[model samples]
Target: MDIKTASALHRLRLISVPEALSFPALLIFGSVLSRVSDIDFLMMPLGVLHGILFVIYGVMLLDVWVKAKWPFKKVLFFFVLSLIPFGGLYGDKVLKREEADSVVAARAREAAQA
Candidate 1:
């Protein structure tokens, strides 16, 4: 992959995990808070933030899949993983492994070309 694509993929990989975790956290917290108090209005902003992050995560997932030439199964796995609480941490681990492999492969390709 080109440097720009690699950079974008790396960034997306980093951001996605936190964003994924944040969504569920906000939901659970908001639900509990609503039951305990009258600060239910908090959920509105949290919901919007979560929604935006979800869309960004989805888009970035597709972008990384295409740019990295990921298999459909792998792509689907991450997509589903994002939906589950704490699954993003697992996804991050997987992405780290993939990133390492990709870096090595890119260097090898460069050496071969040179």
Candidate 2:
């Protein structure tokens, strides 16, 4: 893959962490603290931030999926994974492993060519 295509994966992986956390943070602020804090004021901003991040993450994921030519099942799995709290950490790990494997494969190709 070209650097741009591969870098899309890296971008998606980076956004996954913040996007994952934002949802739970929204939940806690929106639901759990609905009664306890007067900071109900924070709810809208948190929700908006989460919404924006969620959309951005989805877009980045789509970009990566297309560039990487991932299977529908794999794309669906990652989409579902993003919905679960803290699932991004797991996703990050998986992406790292895949990145490592791709790097090794690319190196092997280069070695063979040389």
The candidate scoring highest on TM-score is 1
Off by over 4 Å in 2: none
Q: What lDDT is obtained when candidate 1 is compared to the true structure?
A: 0.81
Q: Per-residue alpha-carbon lDDT of model 2 for 1-114, expressed as tens digits? A: 545655777888889899889888776758678678666777788888888988998999999888888899998988998999988878988887766666676677778889
lDDT of each: 0.81, 0.82
Q: How accurate is candidate 2 locally (lDDT)?
A: 0.82
Inter-residue clash pairs, candidate 2: none
Per-candidate TM-scores read 0.89, 0.86
Summarize candidate 1's per-residue lDDT along 1-114 as a digit string, tens digits: 656556656877887787778867887888789989998899988888878877888888888977888899988998998888888888888777777777777888889999
**Candidate 2 residue-wise lDDT at 52:** 91
TM-score of 2: 0.86
